[model samples]
Target: PDTTVVVGPGGSFEVPLNPPLTNGETVTVIVTDPAGNSSTPVTVEAPDTTAPAPATDVQVAPDGSSVTGNAEPGATVGVDTDGDGQPDTTVVVGPGGNFEVPLNPPLTNGETVTVIVTDPAGNSSTPVTAEAPDFPDAPQVNASNGSVLSGTAEAGVTIVITDGNGNPIGQTSADANGSWSFTPGSQLPDGTVVNVVARDAAGNSSPATSITVDGVAPNAPVVEPSNGSELSGTAEPGSSVTLTDGNGNPIGQTTADANGNWSFTPSTPLPDGTVVNVVARDAAGNSSPPASVTVDAVAPATPTVDPSNGTTLSGTAEPGATVTLTDGNGNPIGQVTADGSGNWTFTPSTPLPNGTVVNATATDPSGNASSPASVTVDAVAPATPVVNPSNGTTLSGTAEPGATVTLTDGNGNPIGQVTADGSGNWSFTPTTPLPNGTVVNATATDASGNTSAGSSVTVD
Candidate 1:
């Protein structure tokens, strides 16, 4: 009989009939069938073992506790249990898979950090998260100091303090015991108003106290001219003299001395016409006021005569000449009468004498002497002028040559005439030359209006 088996192309084929094939078994069968005769048949045996298919669907727990599902037996499991973005801890899965990833320092509040679990199969898990707490509120602040000028504070006449916003801080009066203070809860920002105030507990402030802080002193009182008033001697020079004040003061002092002198120097200057208590104090301090006395500053007047003495006897005084005397102030003091020959004699009532430098005045009933006259009385006479040509009996003098000579008196009166020849000698024939026994007076006058004294000649 013929038999045939079908096999895939390019594929290995083994066949066994009926009983299972064993190792080393061999069999043959005829080939072609259907219309033709077959050729050969073949036999094969199966081998024993083969590897199993790779495992699938590996996974890890969502809480990162452990890994599960099918995987290779000795596979590694890892977890970033701290969620610190790294796989820090590891576990080896024995034939049954399990692991414990301790919560890495337990998660913080409000944090969303990631946790990863990686398997030996190279797979990772999702991240884990936690949250944290919020921050606290800010605190309040305040500041203060004791006083403006004194202990624990600055010393000044004026003080100003300000607040954090540069606003001035308010103030309150110090206690009755004269103490000042301030207290605050918290520190102030830089340049905040502290406390600046002053307290004068004793209340002893001077009117000038306002000047003390600036180191200036008070002004002093002023004194006037500082010298005393002047005094005079004579009432004719006037008595009521006024002393003027150089500065402005109220009270003044004035006084007059025993010699009719008045003056004063005041401690402070006073205004004009300021009434004063004038006390005339003696060396012993005995004082008087409103004393009455005559004041005089002028010299005594010179004595005078209507017809001056030694005045060439012009007319005889029938009623004996009278002379008047007066004082320097032009006030008449007294008069004196002259002797019988019209001689005048006058003695001043005042003892002051010649060269005494006084004003002399006289008034006649005709008012001709109304204007006063100044007189320096000198009773002494002037020295006589000397006579030049000697007293002469006859002049035997020469004349111009060949000229006629004329005899004349010393006053140029012609007494006689004579003629002379060329010799210039002339002799008078004396019709009446200078009468004998006559005493003739001779005066020579020069052309300069000077007259020499007369010379006497006795003719014999």
Candidate 2:
């Protein structure tokens, strides 16, 4: 039954809907006079013309990074990444009613995946849901060579590799069905030890797996001196060398050239006949057997003499070396061998003339001869420069022009020395003032380095 309202004559009336009308229903109203006369009726329609389907059959990623579902074509799909009712991202569905939405941070495996489809008119469908997958097993990685390393792991997992010290070296991802491989940009050396780990889509990493590689070392190099004191050797082309002392301690290292030639010089000269240990190593850390050698290539000690004109000469040299004494003309005068104490002495055939140049040579047991050490003879002394007994510290007189004048105390300690001018006049002042009654001596030396008898004086 329809309800009716009556109003007082001479006015319009207002109607209020307390409960509101149902959607999609039509209503009609008619006006009549008190005499029971009916007027024309008016009709009105309610709002609501369209409905869009919400997303359905949603599939969530095992890692919870994204979700996929079917929605009305041309509709937008939104995902609630945080499991909250509100969507964090919205993506338009393809014409075929397919849609996919990604989440920056993957959701939990057991977390609910809420998704809704919004139509062009802003109408939203019922939300859909799908569960995430479970975590898979850790990956199994294999050993590697200098180049490629292959292994197997959970599908879509990332393989991370590091050196034994936990330094990152390389990384790769596994394909569907769990097969994976990694190839380093550079070649790895033999005997290189490394660790490998697997990272799942959820960012969970597996325990590290240790792997050791084997490599072959180059043949022991032939280490010899490069003409002098440098250590030179040959090894695998492009390899390197580590040098050690007799005690097998590292002393130096060097890389081989393209031709496998390497050389290294010590900061200081090594002692003669010293033993140095050496080994050849490659980039892979593989090393050849240590090769040992005695450093006997050094020259023998140069022969020397105490006095240039002495009838007998003595000096230290390599033990068991042959020492030969020769005149200025290169004629051998005498020969001797150094004793175990490295001491040697040689005497000329007779008293040698003054100004004679004597040279000595030493040949070590290895037949290496030393450079000639020479001394000139100074037999005839220069005329002693004149000095008065009361001259104090001043000493001056005449001798060979350009000769040296030496002043000394009675005890032979040199006071001073001066060279005569072209005119042969010379003088010297004592660095320490002379004391009265002190005895001083003076001598003169010619260009030949001949010293004259000492002339004495008592300081005034």
Number of the top-ranking candidate, with lDDT as the measure: 2
> All predictions: root-mean-square deviation over Cα?
38.3, 17.6
**Clash totals for all candidate models:** 19, 0
> Candidate 2, residues 314-387: lDDT per residue as tens digits?
77777888888888999877889999988887766676787678788888754568998887766677777777
| Model 1 misplaced stretches (Cα beyond 4 Å) | 1-324, 327-333, 336-360, 363-369, 390-460
- The deviation in Å at residue 58 for candidate 1 is 99
Distance (Å) between predicted and true CA of 234, model 2?
A: 5.0
Q: lDDT per residue, candidate 1, 384-452, as tens digits? A: 222222223353444444434444455656555544446655554434345554444433322211233
| TM-score against truth, every candidate | 0.16, 0.36
Model 1 TM-score on a 0 to 1 scale: 0.16
What is the TM-score of candidate 2?
A: 0.36
Q: Give the Cα error of residue 74 in candidate 2, in Å.
A: 6.1
User: Ten consecutive residues with minimal summed lDDT in candidate 2?
Assistant: 14-23
